[model samples]
Target: MHPTTTLLPLPAEAPPSLTQILDEVTTVLCHILPSSLSVKSFSTRWQVLRSKLATLKSSISEVSDSLHWSESPLLQTLLPNILSTLHRVQTLCDQCSDPTFNPGKLLMQSDLDMATGWLSNQIHDLDLLLRSGVLRQTNAIVLSQPVPGSGKEDLGFFIKDLFTRLQIGGIEFKKKAMESLLQLLSDDEKSANLVAKEGNVGYLVQLLDLNSHPSLREQAVSAVSILASASDQSRKFVFEEGGLGPLLRTIESGSTGLKEKAAMAVEAITTDPDNAWAISAYGGVPILIELCRSGSTTAQSRAVGAITNVSKVEDIRTALVEEGAIPVLVQLLNSGTASTQEKAANCISILASSGEFFRALITQQDKGLQRLLQLLHESSSSDTLEHVLRAIYSLSASESISRVLSSSTTFIIRISEIIKQGSIISQHISASLLSNLSISDGNKRAVSGCMGSLVKLMESAKPDGIQEVAANALVSMLAVRSSRKELVRDEKSVMRLIQMLDPKNELVSKKFPVAVVSAVMAGGSQGCRKRLVAAGAYGVLQRLTEMEVAGAKKALQRLSGNRLKSILSRTWRA
Candidate 1:
């Protein structure tokens, strides 16, 4: 007859004392006699089981020293499973030692294999908890004052508990923890700083792995986005922790919602210009371009924004072009939403500013000029128009594109209209665009109608660059006799130009104003010369000439010669 044996009860719902349970398991494993078993296979299995228990004990001991291990929420939550598995090992060893309860070699070997596997898993879970550094963080954290209306709950302890839950639990537990953490981050910037300061950004970055659940990746990316957007320090933490690659991967392969969040995170991180090359290094340009090409509207919007930031790097801008971003970006100029089109326009503008080669890529290969002009006419949003005009301004530097723009009476007239009536920014960029257009002789006549608007902008002269650009445009258009006639005919235009030449008017550049005065003196009607002297031009010109301003001496010579001739002709008539 077999001796009756008592089995250990299942672990209770609540965690048991960690030190007591670990020591008890250690003693039980140490006292086991694998060599006493009759079957060699059973003895071998027992030996393996003992080896796994030793490893588990070593890992526990290594981590237990870092914190109040018995009270650690992570270790405490792990206790029930740890005890369950250890008790199973004990029961199996007891059965192996029992003479009357042999279940045969195969069943015993299978049972031993299952126990070993379970013990290995428990060890893995423990290692994951230890590696999380949550225990050390918890031990060192100083508890803050209770959050208002939370009934004196220790906010620091609660946050650490959430971190523990994230690291040491099943998918559902981690999901809840992620949800709660995200909720906390969303509440305020302070919470985001606290979470990021704990050095757990890598945990969130891990969730961005392609194998993770979609919803989990989405949550992780959303949390990362918040942290990156919170401040420059958190963004540095995200980059240092290797978050960019996974984020780019998510943009490449995640669902629409997930891609938007990931794109947003990428955008925020890349806002630090130093981080821009990492996107290119990770081959994110193609992914972002593809997203701009085919993602959902919101996804496309975010992808375009990220590209805008990433493209700030010179090499990434070339990579973007090499990835065929030009066509895709041009196509986005017609996107149904204003925000998407606006971002696409901003990105295209940036690309166009790179060099003439990129401008050709946007204008020649993709008809970007036409699309921007079309957007110019169709869009009512001032912000969208501002970017679109800026893009057109960028493309206007190309001669072929300039001809196309100058020939379009609608485009020229639109530039005129924007200068006259658009927002201050739109008007500024439009003035610059007109200045660029006026560079080509053929476009000079086309842009001559904008002379009044240009003169008005120069008269405002609040933002000095716009006034300078308008003055340069008038200088170019003065090559056309009629543009010269138009400028000198407007007394306000003549007065503004002379006023800009004053050394006291230091806000506007003297170079363009000097050029304008020289052009007007060289080409204007003699009556216009009289108006220059009348608008306080002689004093400003003499002072500028003394200062050795370029073109100032020639303008002074012309003004002096004209005045001397006028006096001689008057004296001869007398």
Candidate 2:
């Protein structure tokens, strides 16, 4: 970008005179360059060679411009040699831009990286020969590093002047100049950011907006993304350069690939609250949501993440959800690629979890249950299934959910496996869903065999694990008409269920009580209540009458609400 950004110094002494160095540069350009190399190839290698050509051009221009040839024998001889050298360098940059030659494979040459290093050393030797105070031609190669200044100046200060100097030279060298910057962007974010610190970010920003080469534009955007990720300091450095406006604009205008990178850029930019708030200030949500609606899978997924980041504020989150992101996300569950689905799923879950705000979708008011259920069945990955289930649970209201599960008694099998095998997060999902997971009439038939397993489990395990699971499975089993007799007749089965109701014993040991209470409150129409109450779960509820916990509170309310309602109804029947 600008040469003023770096503090690179001039070498006071080194081997090789100016002309000797020019001769070596000439040999490398004319002889070392591949016969098939194009101007673009040579141009991309501009960083390693531009300084020498700039110096040679400067010396020749001086001899022709003002230095009386008679004034210095060096200028007279230097003029002709410089002429030939500049001609070769020009021809090399031209060849690089040609299609007849390959730029890609050529840069990948076996010795090129080493050649670049060697070329750098020769240019260094030439810099040492030029006098510091003499106004040399603007012909020296631009070094993107800090070095000793011409007069102990800050390298960072000279950068803007260097860029302004290039501006005067016109963009004739733009093809090569931009290539150098792109390389700089990828090479080290710190160096790229330094160029930005000197205000070179404006150059990249301006370039992204121009109707330019697709690949080149992408490179420009990618460079900005790199700088933003470099350091916390650089992140703001880019933002202040007026970058987000153009970037968000580009996300709306570019192809899927462009949108993808732009979304990724948004991700890096939104890594913190202030940055995210900046994006929101820049109209981040609408752009991201539009991208989600129109872009490819990767684009949409990343856009979802970007939207989520910016939505960390409640207003922003509500804005997105109100803007109809919920339905769009539900559609995305089946859209895009696998990675896209995973991301969209997560984004939707985050929004669903923020508040009881998504009651419409969760309660089946928006008819989300069936759609979510299908995803849970169709998804192959354990995580994807977990997100779908949680989102469904988060979005739905409980009683409406009950109607949906009424037909699927066996629904808990898939979920039980999730607890046993999935991530800790998903295992928690299993715990959360266990209370609402209903036993289908078919699952009722299956609980008989597992009943024996459940009893054996309690006898040998940790108190919390055994009781929690026993409570959950007991609640589930009590729902089965097919498994009810054996379960109740194990006569001692009633006592085991009763014994688990100890409030003091339940907390450290059990997480399954919600289902246990739900089962007891609902499982017995006649004999079941006495069976469960005989088991002492009713007394346990009595003990918790004065307790508090979000879950325990809900459990107590449900336990009380259903028992009183059941007693009133039964009294009328009598």
Give the top-scoring candidate (TM-score): 1
Q: For model 2, what is the error of residue 310's alpha carbon versus the real structure, in angstroms, after optimal superposition? A: 3.3
Top-scoring candidate (lDDT): 1
lDDT of each: 0.76, 0.57
Residues 1-574, model 2: lDDT tens digits: 8577777898778655555554554454454344324334534456555554454445433433432223332333333444345455555455555668555764444334544454444334223223321123242334344332232134343444344322322243444445555565565445645666664676667767858656657777877777766777777776777777778988988776777777777776787777777766777777888888988777777787777677566667777776777777767777666666666676666767777656554343354565567667677777777677667657544555656564554456655555455555555555455545554656556435545445434443443344455456556665765465566556665565445446655433333553544554553444555555566656666665555432545555554565788789999999
Native-to-model Cα distance after best TM-score fit, residue 524 in candidate 1, in Å? 5.0
Error (Å) of candidate 1 at residue 290 is 3.8
TM-score of each: 0.75, 0.52
Q: Count the backbone clashes (under 3 Å) in each candidate.
A: 0, 46
The candidate 1 region of ten consecutive residues with least summed lDDT is 138-147
Residue-level lDDT of model 1, residues 1-574, one tens digit each, is 9999999999779744677776765565555434224434466777777788778778867765776455554555566677777777667776776778868878878888998898887788788666655556544322233355443224445566666567667678778888888777776566666677753788888988988877777788888878877888888888989999998888877777888888888888888898988988898888888887788888888888888988788877778877888888888888647888888888888888889888877766556677888999999889889888877777777777777776676777777778778888888887776666634556566667667677667756566577787777677677877677667778777777777788988667787778777887776367767778888888998999899988889988877786788799999999
Candidate 2 error regions (>4 Å): 1-174, 184-203, 210-218, 229-236, 355-357, 361-367, 437-574
Error of 1 at 8 (Å): 27
